[model samples]
Target: MLQRAFNKYIDNFRGFSREIWILTLITFINRAGTMVLPFLSKYLREDLDFSYNQVKWILISFGLGSIVGSWLGGKLSDKIGFYKIMIFSLMTSGIAFFGLQFVTSFEGLLVAMFFIMVVADMFRPAMFVSLGAYAKPENRTRALTLVRLAINLGFAAGPALGGLLIMTVGYKGLFWVDGATCILAILIFWIKVKEKKKSKYTDKEHPGEILTNSVFKDRPFWIFLGATLITGILFFQLFTTIPLYHKEQFNLSELQTGLLLTLNGVLIFFLEMPIVSYIERHKINKLKVITLGCLAMAISMYLLLVNQWAGILIIMMLFMTFGEMFVFPFSNSFAISRAPKGHEGRYMAIFTMSYSTAHILSAEAGMDMIRLFSYQNNWFFMGTLGIIGVLLFIWTMKLVKYEPPRNI
Candidate 1:
């Protein structure tokens, strides 16, 4: 039975093109190597002795940079092709990571962080657009899940390794590793994945197309983006506010917090593909799945209200992990599907921008709430925001027509 189950798990990964696997490998290498983000808040607060307000602003700068990067990546991918954009973004960002360790002053760090993120996040939309060229439409959702699985696998390894690096060599070590990995990942991709010529979209390629309207004028998609922004805010708290809370509330060490985060990555790595495959097989409505994910995240926040037990942290991570598993893959597939043929980069860029915007708000808002009110109150606020996201998703469902996945 165990062997059969393992075989079934392996079977879920079948049918992807060789390029998809290579992309997944590149993502893993990059994400695993770029481990600074999960610990950036902690490094700023404890290592540099930055004030909470200073940390918040630095994080906001990071987000603002991400917004610009996403927009640029998408637009440039449409113009110059995703191949060149991916190479440039990763190579430049990798070099920047090496220089970042020297900038310790609050003002200097803010500027440094912003520029680094601007370069780094440009990889996101380019990567998304590349998937459109690489994966078959019928298997797009599964392919996305496969890439996400790689990301989670990298996350699972990165935090634990980052904790050890911090203990032995201090935070400086993270920069060198992150920089090296970005270059390494991109080099591998440059060698292995030959760029394909862009394909033109036609009526037969996408029948009954709803994304025929201008992207700015797509009301349902805008509402969906709003919901995505809210959920992204809720999700990003895992990296920002939640880590601080782990230390302050439970007196967990950096290693302990890293392990807790590793659990989130581990769960997603093992379970997410199967879950996504199951949903696809059942022909589930993507919006409904997204709404369910929103509710799960809200409950995870509310679970944090039980501050007495450290075990509750584990429970909270489980809910948050499952929520992420449900939301992100479907979200990617949905966003890509909504794009008009030639404008994939533009559509994906806007979709990715929602998360970048969320990152800015998540850190600033979370810190403000913690400063003004109690942690419990902050949790209450996040939970309420998640509920609002759920409602918005439901409203979006009413506004947009759902297209079942095509066999072609």
Candidate 2:
């Protein structure tokens, strides 16, 4: 039975194109190199001695840059191609990371962080559009899961490695390594993946069928974006408020905190693809799965309310990891599927922007709540937000069911 299960796990990873695998590899390299983010808040608070209010503004700036980057990346990908945008985003952003270590003042770091993020996050929507070009319709969801697995794998390694770097060489080393990896990942992609014009292969799997409806007019999609925004806000706490809580509440070292986050990455890495595969094979409703994810996230936050034991941290991470697994892959597939043949970049840009917006709100709101009330109150607020997301998703499902089919 163990052997049979192992074989099934292996089978789930099969059938992706070589290009898809290469893309996954590139994503892994880039994500693994991103050691700066999980530790950014801590660096600002402890190393740079920034006030909580100042740190909040800096992170908000990061989110603002991400928002603009997502919009520009999607728009330019549609105009020039995802290939050019991907290359430029990575290459320029990598160079920017190197300069970031030099910016210590609050105002300098704020502007610098915003500028770097603007370039760095442009890679997101472009990469999504590229998948639509490369993967078959039947395989798109699995392909998305594969890329997510790479990201989780990278997350698993980045933190543990980042912890060691901080202890030995300090945070400055992180900037250098992150910069190098960005350049290296893009170089590998440049060498291996030739640019393919979208006109050649887009929508060929279903000839004469294109979703031409304006995304702004899609009521279900707007409702769905609301759900997405809520979940994004809930989930982003892992990076923003959660780390500070680990130190303040539990007295865990950076390495210890990283290990807890590593657990999240490890769980998602091993279990997410299988879960996504099961959902795809069973033809489950994507929104229903997303709702379940929101519920899981709510439970995760509530688990944090039990702050008596360090063990609760592990349990909380588990629930949050499962929530992430349930929400993100299906969300990607749903958003991409909603796009008209040529307008994928636009739709995906908006989808990614919701997360950027969430990042802004999650950081400032979480910090503000912690300052005024308590960490416990912040957790309670985030848990309630997740429950709200669940209701929004259910409403989205009803809207989608009654909605007339779009022209193909």
User: Largest lDDT belongs to which candidate?
Assistant: 2
Candidate 1 error regions (>4 Å): 42-53, 102-107, 167-170, 202-212, 247-256, 309-311, 402-408
**Cα lDDT computed for each candidate against the true fold:** 0.87, 0.89
For candidate 1, lDDT tens digit of each residue in 144-200? Answer: 888888887787778778989999999999999999999999999999999976765
Model 2 pairs whose backbones collide = none
User: What would you estimate as the lDDT of candidate 2?
Assistant: 0.89
Error of 2 at 212 (Å): 9.2
Return the lDDT, model 2, position 98: 92
Ten contiguous residues minimizing lDDT sum, candidate 1? 202-211
Clashing pairs in 1: none
TM-score against native, each model = 0.90, 0.90
